[model samples]
Target: MASVSALAQVDATPRVSAAVTMEQARMVDIRSLVPDISQSIAYAGSNNFVGAPIRGYQAPRCWLKHEAAEALARVDAALRERHMRLRVFDCYRPVRAVAHFVRWANDRADQRSKATHYPDLDKSKLLGDYIAPVSGHSRGATVDLTVLRCDAHDVDCEPLDMGTGFDFFGIRAHTDSPEVNAAQRANRHLLRDAMEAQGFRNYAMEWWHYTLRLEPTPDTLYDIPVTAPTDSGRQAEIERLMQPYDGDVPGVSLLVLKDGKVVLSRSYGRSDLERGIEASPATGYRLASVTKQFTAAAILLLAQDGKLAIDDPVKRWLPSLPKVADGITLRNLLDHTSGMLDYEDLMAAPYEGQIRDAGVLALLEKEDRLYFPPGSSFRYSNSGYALLALVAERASGKSFPEYLRTRIFQPLGMRDTLAYVAGGPEVPHRAWGYSKACDGWTRTDQNAYSAVLGDGGIYSNIADMARWAAALDDDRLLGKASRALAFERQAQVSSTPEATWYGFGWRLADGLQWHSGESVGFRNTIVRWPKQRLTVVVLSNRNDPTPYDLAISIGRWFMADAQAEPH
Candidate 1:
């Protein structure tokens, strides 16, 4: 219930100094004190909610006050006795980083990190409970950490599931939230018990956050950068890795978020080839199947409001549907298990023009049978989502686009996103799709079947997509239970590389929840490693190959060291 005005009332004050000698004399690197302790300094990399290295984190290292370091080392030693080790995510945050958080919170337009951290609450509410101009971490006595299991040799450590990822800005991450499973709650209790034994007090809102009961310098905030002297090479390496996406031809807009923050946002190519408009972060491209998730979300929202139940028969909302859909429920439609026939397949060859969402439902009414019995098997069907959109309209008494505009897009602050309709308002900063031609790039923006609203038809840019990604973190739009249901694996779909399952609108594979979009001249993919808080969104204007491979490669790079305990 936090409002933007409340955030504005908080004072904006700078609170740090650049004296290196004072910091060096008072602080010791936690790793130096406890070399055996595991460390994954999230703020030092792009894998945090901020998405980039925080202002003061120059390196992926943990530093703390001498006393805190000694006490943490004891915690590590004690954990080792039980075949576990203390894995620190953060320690001794710089005051500059705390200030960065404050600035981010104040910028209402910058909701890029909203989905990953503060999904259920407005940015304004975070000022007092979550973020502030000053932080206990700056005192060099506070730490954010988790427990990890180690092999007999104390190597190959893996993090235990504590219900939510570190820095998860939601109630699910609370130490006492009952939303988590029993085992997850137990893991959290174990961490709390261990940390408290060493004079560390856990912050109630954040399971991984802890502060010393008796800090050495509670009043002093340090301004020292967290980077090591040798980190220049690493910075150069990151730049080199992203150099390929810089150009002026029909280009790609890539936005990578790790832990809900934009770690990489690059635009390469042209937004308009005829006008020679260079593509940038504002470039909007049509998202084909990527739009399905939003459609699913709308249905979920209606269900959340008691307007409808997911288990209700499709006929409850759309009485015009054929009798074959009698056994099909809305949940079946959301998860692609409705066994609905593909509308595209039903369309006659040499299609006349673009088809809209209502037209899709009309076409379905003419069909006498389904591809399979409802919930009997798994088959990806665009028809299922299209119908769900219609159901949302019938239940809410609003058009699909209007429902999303007010419910999902506007609420999440996705200012530049929309469900594209044939005669709808023009999309701002639109990136026309293109295909490679013998002469050059050929504009092939929309297909004969492109106007469909539910299955695809959503147009969005990187900035808006980042907000959409952040909304998945908590229950501001959907309750925690509803959000969980969206990602819950409903049926087995494939078994390549690893088992793949179909959730509400997501394809789950090997700890990744992802979906790819493909249109006539546009190809895009959004991959989310939820547990790692890493997301890769690749949006392209050209009809190139699917961006799935590139997205996966990037996801792996960001999650290179992220390992969870075996299920």
Candidate 2:
């Protein structure tokens, strides 16, 4: 759990006070130390894993201890003599910024940066190797940088291709990975040589990362803000939006996107009732069946890559599946027309602990039957999405989460979303799920099959959902054709006056495309009025009273004249 002080100050930079020690005062801005050095602080922008400006990094300027900055200046001069210069990507990361990384790494569901940074590895594997609670950079002695060719006055230069981009979390980014060509290898050597000559040592796992051998303040971790200060009056809007959730129970984090811009973002109620932790915009809520669209998107992404056809039979990948499933195609699975038995219902009465995606297949194999012929009818089946997840993994040679992270989340910059799994990293600012009890609110965070992904088991917040909503409207991830397939009516699953048509993972009725999720102690709904360029995401941590109604009521605010018939 994050400290209240830390959480409260996340958006604010640390200011120097009279009590500051002389050693702390020695910290100097890198620009003042080396006026000519090029800097591009990734965390200060949306380029980092968090997909937003990191906590404490209010500005893009680099800061470092005086001694370390002087050493870096010397290295820059030496590189300039060789008609090259050092361009710093990151320097003097704050302790708060490192805490933000820890929170992100623990969130199994937030893989938006996995593709660009760690496509081949799971987010859980990044904790010890690529990310840690404590970093040398926080001590003001480490820097992430690349080499750039320069001309007179250091203008009109090109960055040397070092095989992999900075902050890439794979073997290719290693100092000696044997994956890069000779030219890229030489470039890495050149950067390392200059830094090492100035008493810096390269981290073996990252070519662009280096720490001074004799750090100026090895024992100190600064909490200074990275960006200059400013005041924004948006807090009033946030407070107003949170007015309804002014109670002791768990709350909701919401975001409204109109015309690709976030007009509202707010949080309410308690994140952890037992700890008396108030919910904030950072709190993550289990998305439940809201995860279905992501699973469907993964299948679509695989199809786009030509790794597998949507019409390919389920057995094409899962050879062990029973003959009954042979008629089921990947498209059938995406659209919930596979007729596969619900794995949740098949689980034993007492309920086994948590079943993973693999366990879902194993259970399905034991049953040698289908509810209906594949693609002939529509019935929402958690089993179909689970199988789709398997197909995606097999087709892409990556886990379901990894594929979504690399292909969808990262591409769209939805940094705070992920298909969560048990034993994975902790969800930062996590809103503990709760249910109404005779006595009071009771913790009901996980169900018997909470670990099973695909159909559900994702966790996210409204800030990230805004990005996701934007992607659905554009051809950023899926092409125009694929997007059409995702939203097109595939089966008339319901025929009543208040009926819904089923698409890949969305429920279509009139001009509205939406989905709702209900788990042990969470309820969520996301509604997109694409024609109006409006999206409303309501994520609640309480199980009672599903959020679909609230989402519909909110949607009316944006769709008064163009309100579509409701389901």
Candidate 3:
């Protein structure tokens, strides 16, 4: 989460979208609307607020029509009179996220998290109960909110104890549920009264939902277009184009892919700082956590060569590593169950000298308490992956970058993708990564950790990602078994449903296997829905969560297009 100070009253986005002709009705670009309605966060942070950091929490990443937002805010004001205000859960959800929700709602395989949230509700009927056949927020006219009350000064909001939490899907979340306590009932009423008073309507089952009496942009929800911008290009353009829309972001970038045709893609504002460059399918940008997939692929390739085993204990490689719970295996390290301390946090604690993988391990040794036993649960750990990079180095007699060059990157003909740095040959058509600092659209300080290959360090474009996806699916990289394992449910997370399935390095969301990468200067996610033969790849150099939601919306549009076809 970002270190937030007091902010002023409701901020509205001010932007003048470059004209979109009627034939090309501009779709909602979530990143463009992030400033107005998002909670502030540090770049590449774990801003879960509720769970283990929400995987996709970028803002200005989305937009709600002006009238719809104002109506919702007025309702929020009404609740304020009752010493309550609507604490928004989500607004202007991206089309991509809606697609993800649909896919998850249809996932009949697991009824586990549902059981935990709604013990009284039948698991088989959740789609009808919680999932909407179509989402209203996609129209940008609805919002999700909960009632919170505190001192008149707007401090310490005590959210009423509703039977179910914000994202919970069950009868308990119903506004007039007889199963709830008086306090819960009162809370639900306050929420409903506030919204209903302001020309809004509530969804009976969810107390947190309300739709604007009128949608401002009816019949015009946009499908974010694809582009390739260096992180610098997006940051610069967002300030100007989004300024009319008043976009405020920590950072952002555009993706460019060549070869594996992009039927459609995403971009923000203009890529050229001087409004010179137009992002294309082949623009190369920094690949933050996306680097992990490459790192994981490299390891699998090593394993295929009989150099390392997935089951090998990490201690076997990094012998000097501080001791952790004995059960933690190499797989745990790769899968993020190692229970080692997050090396980033450890590096921050009154440390000495330049921090490296060894320093990180020392901190983990100091804090060996496990969130859960290895293989029993999953928690994302950059430290775990970083160690794998080192392990690859030790096991194979080459640097991590060199190993990838000789083994994975080179073999697959991913000529453009590399662990790029400042001194390298000027990256062709490279989009610069930028931030809206006190200055403006200035290049972001290159991520200190960008040099590390495991967590985030590789750099490529849309073209490279498409190549990666194709290889993972049908290429002769590591055989079909290795690719299958990459997309399967490897870890069973208790509270985190979307990421329950994590293979080697990919996070499985619905039927789509994907992972989101965020860093000081870039945020990106690529989902390959093999079942549907769809690939939604969104790469932004901005360190915000907007791209994840944006990618999901793009997926929905494609699915809709497919279903409406004459075939």
Error of 1 at 429 (Å): 0.2
Candidate rank order under lDDT? 1, 2, 3
Question: Which has the higher lDDT value, candidate number 1 or candidate number 3?
Answer: 1
Give the per-residue lDDT digits (tens) of candidate 1, residues 1-567: 011111112134433545574356478877456633545565765546666667877666677889999999999899989888776777877667878877877888877878877788887878877886667777778888888775564433457888877777778988999889999999999999999999998888888888889887655668788754232342334333433333224667788886768887766556676654556677788999999889988988998999999899998888888898899999899888889989998887888988877888899999879889999999899998888888889899999899999999999898889988767788878888988887457999998778988988899999899988887886678889888888998889988768999888898877889999998889999999898888989998888778898888767766664554344
Sort by TM-score, best first: what order? Answer: 1, 2, 3
- Candidate 3 TM-score to native: 0.53
4-79: candidate 2 lDDT, tens digit per residue? 1111112234332331332444667665656445555657656566777789776666677788889999999898
Candidate 3 residue 491 Cα shift, in angstroms, is 0.9
Q: What are the candidates' C-alpha RMSDs? A: 20.3, 17.3, 20.8
lDDT (0-100) at residue 470 of candidate 2?
85
Count of residue pairs whose backbone atoms collide, per candidate: 12, 6, 54
